[model samples]
Target: MRFKLRPSDDAFYEFFSKAAANLVRGTELLNELALPGADVQSISERLVEVEHDSDAITHELYNKINTSFITPFDREDIYRLGSQLDDIMDHLEGVGSLLYLYGLTKLPSLPREVHEMVNVLDQQAKLTADAMPRLKSMKDLREYWVECNRLENEGDRVYRMLLVRLFSGEYDALTVLKMKEVADELEAACDAFEHVANTVETIAVKES
Candidate 1:
């Protein structure tokens, strides 16, 4: 067996797992939008709270990276993973805030495709949360990143369909504009999840 020398800092892994779990919370809030008579304003407020929590976790991770003489992985990879995870939360918060700000909740219901995007995000978040702890062993990660990439592709297809519906004149032009903004954020969040997976794959490769 090949031997390797590295610091035994579990804090780095703990931070990643916490950040990822926060993402799961963020996506769960987005899923709440699909409920009948959902409170968009309340969901937006909660998303802000979750986003702030993610930011705090990322800050702590960065400080830990600076202080630690050795890290679980490359220092840059840790930072990138943390930043990308925070980006996903930002996009989730954006979706909630835009829906409330544009009064889109007043519509009878959101497009089916919007919920589809949320479902994709929810899957991605759960996958990332499951994979983060696996970083400790760097084993069985291929399946995680593979599944994440597949989900990202699925999200892209759903996103394209969402745009098609938005531009099909099903609603007034103003409503379409507002919804497109929300759609962009959802798509960005999906992409951000993929970025995190890609970073994980990179770190796994390096440490192998």
Candidate 2:
């Protein structure tokens, strides 16, 4: 076991856990978009609400970092982790908003690979939510970042396949453009999750 002289600031850990849980909610909303005859506008609105909640949590965390003399880890790391988590939510909201705005929901169905991308994000979100609470101990975190990287690679593959499907004369030119934008946001969310994991790995290494 490793030991360090750090304050017993559970609030920082709580903030992280809350933000991660919010991510789980965001991904769940995104998954609803994959269902048949799903209501895109409602999901988009709920996602926006969840994104706002994440923003509030991040704001509170930043304020905590400013007021607290001692933090669980580097203050910068805490902020980066919070920002990265928020970035994921932003991308999620973008996915929903793009679907509604571009009227992509009117299609009979979305490509299978797009849902695969959502599945990857859903896994990442749950993994992150599970890992954030463990930051208080900084134990068993190696699996989190490792698996997150693997999932990101998987998401990349799905994204590439989605683009191929999008551009293979399957969709109209304008529709392809709209879906590509949404795909970009989904891929970005996958990368953002990896960024959070990488930051957590960094904090664990520094404290170890």
Candidate 3:
């Protein structure tokens, strides 16, 4: 399989980059929402806008894939990439939704691992955005996916620590349930980022 540095139609790469930017925005909003005394409603609204923008970009990508005679990568790969990117936004939005629904006045003070996990996720989103446009060349991109995988591992460790603390007679059972739901959503967002990375790696291998 031979890959070209420039595709006949560059719109796909452009859309991918746009979608990645949306993901980064979503991650940043999530980090903000995770902070103490953060305005949850405002941050959630921002995430909602990001998700809507991403959806439009994803739709444009598929439309281009359908109409274009040539593409930078396999059509299926393009579809998978768009879908996984959308999933990341969805999971991030889910985090915000949980925060609002739980009606908690503040983020939990105990078992403070969520902040670190969101930090890793934010880094992963940035790395992914940096790598998406370079897909045309498939050049020096393996490091991004590798780092995302590493971050996902780190997130898992933090998640498990939080879970253990949550169950170890910390808050009441109801509070634990609410906190666990938020934690789980954050962890799922990390996994969604890994899925995006994995899809990018697969596309690179096939194109290589």
Candidate 4:
């Protein structure tokens, strides 16, 4: 029995980069919505566009996977990457929808920190994207993946603090629920980013 190694595709890496960019852009827009008197609906529409673009990239990648005789890494890695990337886009879109659904004309006092967390998460997302193309050079890229992990951990800390603030707030039940939902969406996006980092880490290990 023989195990076969496959050559990596430049296209796959590019698609991965686009996925990362979508998440970063979506989160950046969400943070922008925090501006006083900001037009959230307009920003939400942009997020919708970002989500759609991510879907297109994922679809293209899957099509490539089907036609290729072999994948650059494990087929499971490719699948996980696609799904996790989609997860980020979906969660970001959900956050955008809530802006309209909750009719949240203004950012809650509590979510202000969460928006900051999203900014950091966006940076992490972009860093992860940068590192994806460097998967072949695992030894060199290890630091980037580590930094991404730390940034995600920062997001978790912010989430915990936000939760505390939400529950302790003087808001009505409905407002609290709305705030919680948005905060969770932000956390979910960051969690998806962590998934990307983990997937990249796994790919590094498997390929090396």
Cα distance off (Å), candidate 3, residue 33: 1.3
Per-residue C-alpha lDDT of model 4 across residues 13-131, encoded as one tens digit per residue: 78887787777787788777666777878888888998999999999989988898877777778878988988988998898788767887554443567667778777877787677
Estimated TM-score for each candidate: 0.98, 0.98, 0.92, 0.90
Give the clashing residue pairs of candidate 3, or none: none
Clashes of each: 0, 0, 0, 0
Residue 202 alpha-carbon offset, candidate 2, angstroms: 0.5
Q: What is the lDDT of candidate 4?
A: 0.79
Question: What's the CA error at residue 18 for candidate 2, in Å?
Answer: 0.7
Q: Identify the superior model by lDDT, candidate 1 or candidate 3.
A: 1
The whole-model lDDT of each prediction reads: 0.93, 0.93, 0.85, 0.79
Provide the global lDDT of candidate 3 against the true structure: 0.85
Model 2 lDDT per residue over 1-208, tens place: 7567887799999999999999999989988976888887888899999999999999999999999988888988998999999899899999989988888888889888888999999999999999999999899999999999999999999999999999999999999999999999999999999999999999999988
What TM-score should be assigned to candidate 4?
0.90
Q: Give residue 118's error in model 2 in angstroms.
A: 0.2
lDDT over C-alpha atoms for residue 166 of model 2: 96
lDDT of 1: 0.93
Candidate 2 stretches greater than 4 Å from native: 1-3
